[model samples]
Target chain A: MDLEDLYRILRTGHVQAQGIVDTVPDPMLVLDSALTVQSANRAFFRTFAVDRYDTIGQHLYDLGNGQWDIPELRRLLGEVIPKSSAVIDYKVEHDFPHIGKKIMLLTARTVFNPDNVSHLMLLSIVDITDRSRKEAEFEAVFGELRHRLKNVLGLVRALANQTKAEGVSGEEYRTAFLGRLQAVADANDLALSDHGDDSLDALVARATKPFQTAPETIIVEPSPPLTLASKEIMSLSLLLHELATNAVKYGALSAPAGTVRIRWEVEQGDHPLLRLSWRESGGPPVRKPASTGYGTQLIQFAIAYNLGGNVEQNYRTEGFEAEIVVPLERAARPD
Target chain B: MQKTILIVEDEFIIAMDLKVILERLGWRVLGPVPKVANALRLLEDELPTLALLDVNLGDQLVTPVAEALRSRGVPFAVASAYDKPELIGGAVLAGVPNAGKPTSEWSLLEVLAKLSPP
Candidate 1:
């Protein structure tokens, strides 16, 4: 072939090589034998917020806030490029003079020239900072899920132990246990809203929701925001369930003209505490039970033990009276 | 007159088991009635020798009924999953004693039999 024809062939080969470099999805840099960056593709510019035009002949470390000055990265490029292909992942942080903030992922490899004489290093960078951050968040959620399940199982074991009879079959026991657990879960669901925990407003509302079936049977007083802990919220929820259940059967909810008043306030001043009460009247004459059952125990447990508070349950002539006094610090903040 | 015991339990299956145990012991046994109101109404008409009560009835507390039994001088025992005993004045409870739940048939009847046999 003529020399001019050979020159044209050589020029076409260069164009084809450049075309291959430009089409890659990941950011890349082509460095000469001296390790000076010869060219940067468009993806490199977009990925790293750099100018492809300015990268020509610049050293890799001189660009983009000198993030490449990391000793690890330099060592990787120095020793790793001469032997077999080296793979690495590293995060480089840089602030764009114009763009707010930026993070980058860098991968690089050495390339041999045609005839295997000279060398060139090609860096392939995939920005993965966002993906890594989301992955971390997902792991935290899974951890919390595992913890919650453990707590539920622990409570079920306690319930099973305290029940006097191995009376129900495994299937039936599971169903019944689920029933109560669902009730408690519902209470927790209401108490724990979009946020991780409930605000005082939401917690009271949660306690009052189920009783709304017989509206006005239970009264709730306005109180300030006091974060209730999960344990306190669950205990209080169970108390409301028992009280409302009683109201439905014999107390205010039992009669058309009957009414119940429920109110709460975080006692302030020197000693901050919480006081709540359930007062029922107008349904039937209050008398003591022939035996104590789960409800009574739960009420007592809620007020006296869980909240570390005072409880007074009085079987008055007209209706039943219940009071709970708890310390304010026992509250939970919503997520 | 034979000693009679009335059973008030919220759980149906639980009440049935207790019935078998109480009847096997030669006690004149009435219903395994499942609610506070029903038990109270029944007792208002005919008093039993003793009662076995469960406090939380899913929708009510049977504490008032316990009080009614105390006023009428009838003895009773408690069977429940909850560990508290405020309704029976801890003293009376110590004598009759509540059987904390998930108990076997043997333990259940044993507790029932020990309840001041007439």
Candidate 2:
């Protein structure tokens, strides 16, 4: 009723309001009609890395050496708030000296003080830098996947055209085309199945699994555990497929008594190299072909060009042999 | 004389098929080189009437080879799965002909026709 009594009530209300603002989790600020910050919550200081002394009574755009002076932020606070009485999700991206680049979402509402009939703005800031970064990374990964898919499809189209043009019978072309596509599909499946690198033995087994009549017929020599990158796995798998296909038609696997032996070792040095050998024995006496075929070109390309390695195919009188030496760095295993 | 065309693609199957299509069309096919280094070497040793280049060569871009072919005045067309101009460096490939990936034989021939020597 009296002047002193009214003053006490006002002081208590102010303290209560300040305590409530400090308890809020998101950064918040109270600004007068002039757009000068009258009060800030504890979160405001922590989120922006500024002290109350530097923030209070300062223009919102002038805080932290003008790091808060974002063009989008200015439009939201200046035009949007005045017209609409509120703004939601006003995004601002700025490079702050202390915290680097950050993405912030701001929401603001106009509040009127009944006693003075003056308008005040209540602003809240949400730091969305981490979420925005993760979203961008996910988009990039998806884009890469789409690009790779397109390339794979392109390869498939080319394969079909080449097979059809080879003058092979329709059935033969169909079989051969499907076989090549399956090889590609198998490699892709292996790459996506597990995040960890694939073992060399696993790769060989997968490639040769479809061609083998019995496990013991095609001997895979015991070798140390070695892992290969996904790209290397795909190339090597396709390479082995071509080799096994040749063996099935004309090499060791064509005959019951014939045998094929695959062995590999890692030569450790300044740059580690994987030395792999494929040897066939006891087949019909072998002779080098006069002309190169698509299969031969594929093998050479996969090993030499794709793997950044060297491949030598020697058709000895007794059997056929292929030796491959590839750099370890290019085909690194997951540590 | 049959025109000799060189192909520089990283994918083995694609390169092999391109060779077949070109040969069927009565063109002599030269090195379907898969690496930038190999492609550059082949370009220096043998000159083909035209070249078809894949923009991405495994871990490397084919821009340097493109630049080389440009300097030699060798007409070539770029083949890539990437349609985004920026991804393939728009400025570098502004005037170069492009054949989008998954290109049919007809599409490939169309682009090659554009680069055929007069």
Which interface RMSD values do the candidates have, in the order shown? 12.0, 1.7
Q: lDDT tens string, model 1, A111-170?
A: 677897888878877776678778899977875565355445435544554444466577
lDDT of 1: 0.68
The C-alpha TM-scores of every prediction are 0.57, 0.82
Question: Candidate 1 chain A: minimum summed lDDT over ten consecutive residues — where?
Answer: A326-335
Identify the candidate with maximal TM-score: 2
Q: RMSD to native for every prediction?
A: 16.2, 3.9
Judge candidate 2 at residue A114 and give its lDDT.
Answer: 88
Computed on C-alpha atoms, the DockQ of candidate 1 is 0.02
What local lDDT does model 2 show for residue A246? 89
- Write candidate 2's Cα lDDT for A40-142 as tens digits: 9999999888999999999988988887788888888777887898888888888889988889888999998888978899999989999998999999899
